[model samples]
Target: MDALLSLSNDLAAAVERVRGAVVAVNARPRLPSTGVHWRPGIIVTADHTVRSDEDITIIAPDGRTVAASLVARDPGTDLAVLRVHDTDLPLADLGDPGSLKVGHIVLAVGHGPRVSWGVVSALGGRWRTWRGGEIDQLMRLDLTLYPGFSGGPLVDVKGRVVGINTSGLSRQLELAIPVSTVTRVADELIDKGHVSRGFLGVGLQPARLPEAFRRRLTGASEIGLLVVNVQPDGPAAKAGVLLGDVLVALDGAPVGATEDVQAVVGARRAGSTVTATILRAGAPAEVSMTVGERPSRRR
Candidate 1:
């Protein structure tokens, strides 16, 4: 009983520390949501929770309501950055999400300063969404994210923000976009009003290489991305890439998953050429293609 009581006090204190930087975002005609005061005059929330750029109100920690303007938004990561007139807003101490490990205790604080505690259930490496958004890291928690909790902060016991929690992107799991990803995306959104990504115009799925082929490429991965479709006149098609070809590597880096391809393509500028190593008919071949800017609609 003593141990349980001590744990409760620790959690309560952590929540109280984080509550100083938490804000309730009331985008009219939409449900009230939560946001983190990431910096002076800047609030970060879930992009899905923010319906529009106009007529938004921010309920500060002290319960003083003030108007806020939408600075920028990225639907791919489900993050939005809003600007308020108040520079005195308390800022959250951002933690390194990369340091988070499975079983670590985390707290999600939402509107009304509601707190939910849980453990980090899983952590995934870099991956791309079906929409082609490049995520630096994937973190999921075993916590119940209630309504209006979409844009809240997921913090550690030290009261440092681990990430932004959102339920809009995943149906079966509670996902927190890591602080590293959020910082990168938020910076780009603030500077450019949009995020740019590279494209190859090819649909790919995971495929396994035959035993003999895997042995031939001793240092290479056993799995690769199988091209299922190629857009006509697109970069891949223009470079003679075809359907059914298995992409094994990009510019010397192993291409084992869709995320690997995305990471390579996203790192390159449009109009730049990249060497694609593929297995066509059980034989390895190399093809060079110019990277293209990913269409905004696709993003």
Candidate 2:
């Protein structure tokens, strides 16, 4: 019974420590969400939460509402950084998500001083979105993310922020953008007002190689990305990459899916040469292509 009381008290105190760093974000025409005071005059939140150019209101812990300006936003990672003037909000102590393990206790804190307790359900390594955006880490939580919690912080037992909660990317699972990813994106947004990535103009899908071909490769990967389409006059076509070629590796690293290709290609800059290994007509071939800059989209 005493142990149960101690646990309750610890959780309560943890929530209090995180509460001061959270603020309610209200972007007109959308439901209210949460934001974290990352530093003096700087706030971070999910990009999808702020869709319009209209003004944004931030409700502080003491119920003081103030205006905040949208500094920069990156839809690829679903992260945004905002700036508020004349404010000295408490900043959250960021923690490393790479050290998080399954079953570690955590708290999801949002506006209304709302708090929910849960454990880490799963941890995933680096991956890329279909749009070719790279995610540093993927985290799944056993807790339910209620309304107004989309851009809130997920805190560890010591009240350090582990990640930013968002359900925009995943449909059935509660996901958090890890602190490492958030900090990197936030820094780029602050410095350059945008993030840049390399692009390879090709549509691809995962394909399994025949057993005989796999044996010929002899320990090389059995799965690869099959090129379905190549953009006209784009990097792939310019480099002689053809339809029906199965991409097996980039820069000597094996690629089993589109995400792997994205991770490799995105890491390079425009005009940089990268070697691509592909299976063409039952034999492996290497093609070198210059990476291209990803064109800005109409958002």
Best by TM-score: 2
Off by over 4 Å in 2: 28-30, 130-132, 202-248, 253-260, 267-273, 278-285
TM-scores across all candidates?
Answer: 0.78, 0.82
Q: State the lDDT of candidate 2 residue by residue for 86-200, as single tens digits.
A: 8877898888786789999899998878988899999988876544556888799999898889899999887889999988778888989899888888998898787778888
Per-residue lDDT tens digits for candidate 1, residues 1-299, read 99999888888888888898999999747579999998788899998898867889999888999899998888878889999884687789999887899999999999789988899999999766555566788898999898899999999988899999999778888999899888988898889787777889999999988888877665668898999999999999999999999999998888888888887898677999999989899898999999997776522
Q: What is the C-alpha RMSD of each candidate to the true structure, in Å?
A: 4.3, 3.4
Candidate 2 clash pair list: none
Supply the global lDDT for candidate 2: 0.86
**Alpha-carbon lDDT, every model:** 0.87, 0.86
- For model 1, which pairs clash? none
